[model samples]
Target chain A: AQSVTQLDSQVPVFEEAPVELRCNYSSSVSVYLFWYVQYPNQGLQLLLKYLSGSTLVKGINGFEAEFNKSQTSFHLRKPSVHISDTAEYFCAVSVPTGTASKLTFGTGTRLQVTL
Target chain B: EPEVTQTPSHQVTQMGQEVILRCVPISNHLYFYWYRQILGQKVEFLVSFYNNEISEKSEIFDDQFSVERPDGSNFTLKIRSTKLEDSAMYFCASSEAVRSYEQYFGPGTRLTVT
Candidate 1:
C-alpha cells in the first residue's frame, strides 16, 4: 500500500515570492510520484510526474518538484508565484503495476497568493 | 487536447435514492477510474475499469456501489442507495494505455445527497 502526507494544510505567499509545498510518502517498494493542481470550479490538472530518472521534475506554470528518495519526500516548488497561481495542490503516489493502478493522494495544500 | 468528460455537473437526491454518474473518457484511452473527495478530505479512489470490467477497487467501493461500461463510449457509476455521507465531488479519469501513468481527469460531478 501507498500513503501520502502533506505536512501543511495551507500556505500563503506574496506575489512574486518563492513557495514550497511539502509532501512525504510511505511505500514498501518503488512507486511513481505526481503533483496535481485544481483551480476554483474546475477539476484536477496534472502538473507533473516522476516515474524514473531525474530527481528534479518540472511541471506546468513554472512549477517544479524534487523527488528525494532518501527522505521519502516529493516537495513542490516555484521560484515566483502569481495571484493566478493560488489554488489547491495535491501530492500523489502509486505503485507501478503491469497495468494502471490507483493513486493515493495527500490532504492537499491550499496556496493562497496575495498582493 | 483530448480530455475526459462527465455529465450532470451537480446532482441532488434524497436518501435511499439511486444515482448514476456518467463519464466519457478520451478517445484513445483504454483505462478508466472513479474517485471522490468529501469536503475537507483527501481524494479517495473508488475503482478502476478496463475492457468492460473492473480491474481494481478500494474498500470504499462496497456492495452499494457498482460500475458498468454499458457501451463503447460511456462509463457509469451507480449508487444503489445514497447516504448523506455519499455527498461528495466525484471525478472520472482515464489513461491512454497499460503502461501510461498519466491520467486525465474530468471536471467532476458534485453529488449532494439529502
Candidate 2:
C-alpha cells in the first residue's frame, strides 16, 4: 500500500517570504509525485510533477519541489508568495508500475500568504 | 484551454435518494475517473472508467455505486442510495490516455446528503 502525508495542516507566511510545504510518502514500489493547488471553490490544478528526471522540478507560479529518494519526500517551495497563492495544496502519488486507476492524496496544507 | 466539466455544481438530496453526477471530459481524452473529498478530508478515488468499462474501483465503490459512459461525451456516476456519509464534493477527471497520470479535474459537484 502507498500513502502520502502532508505534515503541516496549515502554514501562514508573510507575502514575499519564502515558503516550504513538506510532504512524505511510503511506497514499496517506484511512484510518481505531484503537487496540485486548489483555489476556493475551484478544481485542483496541477502545479508540477516528478516522474523520472532531475530531482529538482520547477512548476508554474514560481513554485518548485525537490524529490529526495532517500527521504521519500517531495517538498514544495517558493521564494515568494502572493495573497493569491493562499489556497489548499495537495501532495499526490501514483504507482506507474502497478494499478492505473488511483492517485493517493495527502490531507492537504492550507497556505495562507498574508501581508 | 481544454478541461473537464461537471454538471450540477451543487446538489441537495435526502438520504437513500438516488443521484447521478455528470461529467464531460476534454475532447480526445481516453480515460475518465471519479474522486470525492469529504469536508476537511483527503480526496479519495472512487472509480476509473475506460473503453466504456470500469478499469478500477476503490473500496468506497460498493454495490450501490455505479459508473457509466452512456454517450460519447458524458460520463456519469450514479449513487443508488446516497447516505449521509456519501455527501462530499465529487470530482470528475480525465487524462489524455491511460499512460497520462496527470488528470484534468472538473470544478466538481458538491453533493449534500440530508
Candidate 3:
C-alpha cells in the first residue's frame, strides 16, 4: 500500500512570488506520482505526473514538480504565481499494476495567492 | 478531446433512500473509476471497473455500493441505502487502458443526504 503526506495544509503567497508545496510518500516499491489542481467546486484537473525517466516534470500554468526518490518526495513549485493560481493542490501516488491502478492522495495544500 | 461526463450535478435525498450516479467515459477509454470527497477531505477511491466487472475496490465500497456498466457507453454507481456520511462530491473518472495513471475526471455529482 502507498500513502501520501502533504506537510502544509495551507500556503499564502503574494502575487509574482515563488512558492513550493511539499509532498512526501511511503512505499516499498516503485510508484507513479502526480499533482492535480481543483478550482472552487470544479473537478480535479491534472497538473503534472511522473511515471518514469526524468525526475523534473513541467505542467500547465507554469507549474512544475521534482520527484526525489531518495527522499520519498515529489514537491511542486512555481517560479511565480498569480491570483488565478489560488486553489487546492493534491499530490497522489499509485503503484504499477496490470489492471486499473488506484491512487493514494494527500490531504491537500490550499494555495492562497494575494495581491 | 474526449472527457468524462457525469449527470445530475447535484441531488438531495433523505436517509435510507436509494441514489444512482451516472457517468460517460471517454470514447476509447477502457478503465473507469469512482471517487468521493467529503468537505475538507482528500478524495477517496471507491472502486475501479474493467471488462464489465469490478477490478478493485476500497473498504468504503461495501455491499450497499455497487457499480455497473449497464450499457456499452454508460457506467453507474448505486447506493442501496444512503447515510448522512454519504453526502459528498462523487467524481467519475476514466483513462485509456494503455495509460491508466492519467485518468480524466468529471465535474462530479454532489450527493446531499438529509
Per-residue accuracy of model 2 over B19-47 as CA lDDT, tens digit each:
99999999898889999999999999999
Kindly list the per-residue Cα lDDT of model 2 for residues A1-115, writing each as its tens digit. Answer: 8999999999999999999999999999999999999999999999999999899999999999999999999999999999999999999999884334478999999999999
lDDT of 3 by residue, A1-115 (tens): 8899999999999999999999999999999999999999789899999999999999999999999999999999999999999999999999989679988899999999999
Regions of candidate 1 where Cα sits further than 4 Å from its true position: none
How many clashes in candidate 3?
A: 0
- lDDT (CA) for every model shown? 0.94, 0.94, 0.95
lDDT of 1 at A51: 97
TM-score, structure 3 vs. true: 0.98
> Candidate 1, residues B23-95: lDDT per residue as tens digits?
9999889989999999999999999998888989999999999999888899899998899999999999999
RMSD (CA, angstroms), candidate 1:
0.7
- Candidate 3 DockQ score? 0.82
Which numbered prediction scores highest in DockQ against the true structure? 3
Where model 3 places Cα greater than 4 Å from the true spot, the runs are none
